[model samples]
Target chain A: MKSIKEINQKIREGNICVVTASEMKDLVSELGVEKAAKEVDVVTTGTFGAMCSSGVFMNFGHSDPPIRMQRVWLNDVEAYTGIAAVDAYLGVTQLSEKSEEYGGAHVIEELVRGKEVTLRAISKGTDCYPRKEIVTEISLEDINQAEMVNPRNAYQRYKAATNSSNQILRTYMGTLLPNFGNVSFAGCGEISPLNNDPDYRTIGVGTRIFLCGAKGYVIGEGSQHCPPYGTLMVKGNLKEMKPEFMRAAVFPGYGVTMYVGIGIPIPVLDAEMAKATAIRDEEIWTEIIDFGVARRERPVIKRVNYAELKSGKVEINGEEVRVSPLSSIYMAEKIMKELKRQIEAGEFFLSAPVERISKDCVLKPMRLKEVKLVRSVMTPAITVEPETSVEEASKIMIQKGINHIPVVKEGRLVGIITSWDVAKAVAMKKVGRVAEVMTRKVITTMPDEPVEIAARKMEKHDISALPVVDAKRRVVGMVTSEDLSKLLAR
Target chain B: MMLQLKFDPKTVKKPIISLATLEASALLNIIRASVGPREGELVVEVEEGKAEKVVEVLKSYGVEVHSIKKAVERDEEKCVHCGACISICPVEAIGFDDEKRVVVNTTKCIHCGSCVNVCPMKALALP
Candidate 1:
């Protein structure tokens, strides 16, 4: 069994201890106040009185305002030359002693002391005028003047303003100090309320409170703010705080700190540091998500049939088998069993046509190795000859269900005619014969040439087919798109 | 048209004197010590009208000047026929004659302690 101290230590180390104010209370109750105090270094009271009485000073006005003169002093002529150089070099002179005096030496002394003084100085052995002005205007009056009715109201306003300012400051700081290793903030009212502390006054709501890079008084309450009795110290790693605060502080122009107060009994500094670390870890996780580094879920497996497979063979999807009689028989049996299972499951529908799987999987497709054009193919060519009369050629073309024919003279290649040629001539109402309209310069290819080459030549010339001829220039066969389609289908 | 010559890291030569080895004063001393006086010789020269301006600029940048003069020459046969002055010529101006005698051309010489450092013959002297 663990000792009470060990158990308390374990609780403090766990992630749950850092979440909220109530959880911290529960932890303190379970572990006892002394152990809890040891676990959490900083505590926040929800009351404005506790926060203000605790001597936690916040500056809300602009920083580094223009310098101004408070008073002036003068010195003897001999002292002026000697002390002026030293005062000028040091950028300050003692003038409080001579503030009541109004004279040239006194003014010069004031100028040397960095007081707003108009005076003359010797330059290159000649006196020259030197003008200086001091602007002094930084005080509590610069703070927003909204009145608070009660401590709770003051605390709420302070928190709201601070949170809003922090949102902006976080963004700016993120860009300006990207490498700030860790960040933490500690105070009361924002995190908790004052309990039984009469000397402390409540912080007014919306009263400007400044902390680190975050500015503003207060905003809405968060779960982290509870059981207002102690100062709350927020801690987090820089990595975590960067994005959380950077978004508001840098890009969108808001002031906000990205730290969450860890309300454990550990040292305030340690708790703040731990918070920073936790924030950094959270930021790393966020980065991972943003970069799409998460693991994907598995896809559902679906059953497929032999006819649906793109390989032109039926086999188990991932199983490899040799092309042998026994293996083929075994595959057939397996397929039968798979089909039976589908049928028993009532998934196999006879009325619905099964779709073929994608053709992308096919390794190779069958094509025509050799084409033998017999009398049937030759007759189509003969009907569209150019020498034949247009009427005769049209009659033959209509009867043969062919559109083009080779025009041969003395059994030698000459020209070709087409139904389109006769139709065009008729449309123009020309009296010319078929020979006049037939194309004389014929495009031809060899029978041995590849089908693809013939197709490319036809496409290049924008013609339908190329007449395939032998070495003796005798027309042997003709290759067309329809023939190529039939070949590809196989 | 303005032309800029950039000195990339790849091309700069090693300095004759390492900055780590000597202070600025010592370096200037070494440069000044390199020149020595010679009879009828002008050891250093500044362009006709630019001497004062050049000195001012150098001074502004903390450079020191030593003696200034014109050139001088030594006859090959004028010496005691000893080669003592050869090593004393700081700028490597002294050489040996065919008979192994010393010869000095003051124009190329900066009168430092080159021959003065180890002049066994003591045949040469500075004005």
Candidate 2:
């Protein structure tokens, strides 16, 4: 194999023509590995998707009367303040205290757009660092340096998700339409950078890359670095397998996200690396996972190539299912093209990895120190007599600002009335007492019951509210969808 | 001439706009009119020399007339063939070919632009 220095000299002499990882596959076949490796100078690899493990570190320079930040927040989203007095790490999943939907990702996006973010921090004044608390606004430009340093980023390939249960599941896999309506997968499929280079030889610490429209580098192999696999043929060591055999994974939570780092090796030294760069989608394979099952090992329904997945249809257990990709192949291509343009314009260059990643690393399952469920937020049930008039019940509902009202006879829930029932009764011109219109059969939940059980009951029955009843069947409190939402947001 | 006519339901509640007052001076033949709950779109054909007259008639019924254009287009440069546009297509116009590249069949496209709206890569376009 030619040395990295020799490859650089060839690149400097303009003796090599750069090719993308996807393009190199065809070139290798056409020119043969030896000749193509000699001709090609560099290969560009890229990926683009949401990666939750990603976070950025910024030095906001000291504010006036600079406080030692013990607890920090950006735009109401908490940031880890354990580093120094003025620096902080903003995680992607950190949610804003003001609104759960507005998280650190949104804050980062806002900062990237050059918008100012409010910084809030509380500290115990020290002799050296005396300020106790500081609240200020700052922008990315105002920071001394803002760089994203994620331990794990690009994964080689990932499994697609589908639901087998009759009920709809809200997961990190997006909303799995009930009964396998559509499957969601993420990755660049063919043009992805890591998919192009299955082995870690070329991608490791100190490798310059394009990260989120900015220049970055590969610090090391990401977390959960699984063994590299290749096709059925040419199986020897980690680097010998076909690109399709490479697989890496991360934990699945409410939803799954991937981080992508597009890197271009400055110079291609040999045909072996050239062939690796030439991997195709037809050769890359990933498994289909049935997320419906709640177990440590989710069942594998099928193993398909990227080509079939990209076609939008795959037959699993003899049924055709539609597919959706969470990864942005368009953005990946755009970055690749942009990187190429930068290289051609002499504005971008590549650097060799200073240190290699340890392939011997293994992913360990996360062990919870302790799991506990505390009950403190169930909304108290507002009751109405079964003999109450529909108009009076409606008035009570409107006045109390509650959608559901429990109809009790002798302190015991006999039925339930919803605003929808009142609206429908009025529209149908059926004037009667609350009992006449209220649902006689009420699904009640116990206050001590697990929140998930209540949630599942609501989902199964397609109901929004449930009355909490005691052992004597007396109405105690209520758990509506709103209450559950408030509980989950915490 | 082929035109795309959009009927706004907010302006007129009558399911059939033609049931209302019709000047009828313009002789335009509607090839197909897909009326949905919120709005309706029609592909109309008019006599070679009576295109302007037909537009006037359509406009009288609050139908916004538009030119026949590419409803779905694939930006070949950006497409990574992830198949995100396939499931969202109201019409199965966009699908994978034997070569596995996502291709748009313009003839079968209804111009609903569902694929364009769902394409994460912004590789699909409608005009």
Candidate 3:
């Protein structure tokens, strides 16, 4: 059994022995585990997924007149500035204060690419530190230390999830296609780091890893790391396990996301460690679960190996379902290759864990007590009488930022006038009143009707607005796409 | 003188396998064809006015044609220009227009769906 020192000696002598987990697996099969272990020096593992728990700690070196940052934002994503005068932690999934589409994850990616990011911070002025705020742009080079430490990442085994329900699910699993049209699995099953080192053997606190584009380490047992198999011995090949092996998690209003981490350990030990490294895609398994059920006991639709999932199609519940890898396998392979290159060039080396990851940590379910906040306000609809000129109706729409105005007569609804109808009239050069351009068949909703029903009616009729009407058919409020979105956001 | 065709392997095995041979025999000219795990993405060339016949033959063999275009097409109505598609694109096909709308450069796009898969809006699709 060759030790890690020997591996280093070989590297020093330019006889670096390293192989990817996949290659190591092949070697073990060809030369037997013991022999393969003797020859190989390191086995690299990798995973690239939406790790929500990922974040970076940065020490933005003191500004001219140092201000203890009370509030910090990196590209508009709030970062924790409570640590010190210049240090802050930015979570990957934190939505941008300016735009929901941009998040802390995007910021991390940009930093890795050496792109400049706008840094803005606000602080109460102190006698020692005079500046109250600072706005600047910084790149990775500008920060004293920009380190990524994900609380959890490359999961050992992840479940394939789909919505069996009719409603489309917007989840961290990506969008769950309606009616199980598509299934999303978030782990690089075979090639993943934790999947290969199933028992945590050499991977734990202090183990060095390639984090995002930087070097990071395992700090401790990640939050909610209750692996299906016990710490003693990871049982049967992943393929044969029942659906009970899978875990279903929900982040409440945020939708569901799996717990995972990407901490690839550099095995510095003997051949047994080498054998542990040689796990392949065919050996790892994950569950295909119907995530439609609200209970923790999600139904297992199938038990398939990662190989079958990697094939892009898998038969589950007697139907062939299209499988999409939420994790980027391409990025994972790129990481493995880069790690191999670093090792071969003696640019990077292995380090032992300071602590072993705890096996007993269980994920506690998130239970939010039911609290209701009633919104009693509804903006009254601005009505355009049927006799109003089309030009006048168009002016009203433009001013109100609204696309549709109810064409009412006296105290009752007559029709609806839309921006499209106005534009069509203008294009046709028809000089007429609202009645000439308005759609006579208007879909109206009662004031008590749920905003969802009104939204659906608008969608069904391909209209932009549904006028909220009273018992006498007089317009009271208007539910538009914007209103429905506000309701759904709650 | 090139065309890209998509086919499903689960349905049309014979027609897909015969494509390479058909190219050699001058039945069709091929640039590349990838019959991957999900579907077939082929770049081929057919004589003028004979493209319809080729599609017909492939369809008869049970291949579902996804798109028959010179390059990838992006539904402008669906795109939110969120920039999610920008990072994963192997080729710099999809980019922001001056108005900040994501526009696909049909010339550069290989229809890899690298952008399509990661698009949160589901705006990008294979062609």
Candidate 4:
């Protein structure tokens, strides 16, 4: 078995052999894994796709007077200023306050393209740094530090997406057509960095990589990183990145995301490593998730191999649905080829990890104790007895300038009276007590329920209002479609 | 000779393309489309002699039609030949050449803007 040290020595002497992961497959098949492992020094792997959890950290270098900025913005897109005085982290998907398309990803792309961007900041003046506001233009050359630190990149097993609902779904996975019209998926598959070393055998903290046209390194395990399978936290030099490899993209309905090209070299330490790099698209399977569920845990329709997906079609629900890849295999091949060239020329070398990723990465949902319930959006209920006359109910409706009134008996909702029922009663010439015109079997909601649940209930019943009640069924408040619509509009 | 047709959400269900073909007597060549239940966009080419007639027929049914000069401006220098736009075009207007560089068949392209939107490098843009 060859060690990374011996490979580096060979690389230094200009006698090392390197091949792309795709070519490695052919090499391993021709010359058995054991012999190929001895002949090849490194197998380069690459992937290019939209990575949303990506951002850049920049130190704009203190202003003339040195401002301790409380809020910072680049090209009208706000950057996270929770770090130091002048340092900020700009997330890729952070949208501009003024427009949907312009975002921090655009800012990163502009900086990489060597264009200048306006920088604005506002702060509560302190005695040591008495600057309230500052506005200036800055470029990559002007910033002292421009480092890309993506929390998650190069997913080992990416999921393909399709829609099962009747309406079109505009998601981060791209626009999904209604009724399983098309399938959209990402990942360069077999050549992908994490896919080549799924167990992180040779890849871990401090492993050198080709990160978006620059030499970069893996820092640690990223969020949602299912062990043995992979997702990596990577960092790279933003100034060295090329626009072709690291560009900003705005999916029509979704916000902006960055497309990153990442390549990793797998040193042929043994037959196992050689076999790992020889994995093919037909052998790798990804889940096809139905994105129409509108939930965190979407339903997985089937496990389909990348071979079928790349062939432009896959069977879904017993029908041939056209397949489209969001990831660019063309760019991935270029990255793999360029990396192979670099390794052969002895310009790049493989480095072992400083630390192995932790195996105990259990993803947990954020326990939001302050979650907004229906009570927060509901209006306090006004109630009347069933014995109340229709004329009095109509008078109360006009006085309150409201549409519906809930009728209660012994602190429990029995019926609901609307202005329409009053009009119908008048038209039918049957003016009587509230019970005669009121609608029983009211579709009620609970105060403790989430606002979305109430909204869905109203939509299902095709009604405008709902009575919010407690365990005793007493109407505590009222919620209407108007409140939900206003909240959505805001 | 290429024509782009846009159907709003209400008009998408109409059998406009077949009707236009029968009435105009033009065997339209579909180059690209991105139609959904909400709305639809189509790019088609008609014969030189019957191009004006097809446009007139489509317009009679309230279809927004445009005779395309060029679907988009392709910046060859910036394009990385990524296949992100390959199958995204309803019509196979964008395809890889022998060397795998994205070749835009301007004559057959419908200017649906799908490729232009998905190109991360910004190599494709509206003309």
Best model number under DockQ: 4
TM-score leader = 4
| Cα misplacement distance, residue A449 of candidate 2 (Å) | 14
**Candidate with more favorable, higher DockQ: 1 or 2:** 2
lDDT of 1 by residue, A21-45 (tens): 3234455546655555446532222
lDDT of 3 at B115: 59
* Residues B5-117, model 4: lDDT tens digits: 89998779999999999999989988778899989999887899999999999999989997779767788866655566665676677776664467888866666687777
For candidate 2, the TM-score is: 0.64
Go through the candidates in order and give each one's DockQ: 0.01, 0.24, 0.04, 0.29
Per-residue lDDT of A1-490 in model 4, one digit per residue for the tens?
9889999999999999999998999998999889998899899998888899999999989876778989999999999999899999999999999999888989998999999999999999888778889999999999999999999998876889999977666778877778997888888778888778766788999999999989999999887997534789999999988887876877776788888899999988999999998898898887899987765678999998888887778898789887767877788888999998888888898899999886655777777766667888999989988999999999999999889999999899999999999999999987999999899989888887778878877886799999998899989999989988988798
TM-score for model 4?
Answer: 0.76
What does candidate 1's lDDT look like per residue over B1-127, in tens digits? 0011112232123221223123222212233323122211112334445445444443443333334453333432222322323322445566544433445666565555444422322234444
Q: Write the residue-wise lDDT of candidate 3 on A1-490 in tens digits.
A: 6555676777677778878776777888898877876677788887655556656678899998898998999889899887988899887667777865666766765666567899999988899878999999998778887665556566676777778966655566655656776677767776788777766777777677765444556667665577742111111111111121111122222432222223364572666676677777778777888866534667888887888876666775678776666665655666687778877888767776667786665767788563221123246789989899998898898999898899889889999988999999999998599999899988777766555556656776687678878889988887777766776688
Interface RMSD for candidate 4 relative to the native interface: 2.7
Tell me the TM-score of each prediction against the true structure. 0.19, 0.64, 0.60, 0.76
Give the clashing residue pairs of candidate 2, or none: A25-A278, A50-A258, A171-A254, A172-A254, A172-A255, A229-A245
Categorize the docking of model 3: incorrect
Query: What's the best-to-worst order under lDDT?
Result: 4, 2, 3, 1
Chain A TM-score for candidate 4 is 0.80
Candidate 2 CAPRI assessment class = acceptable
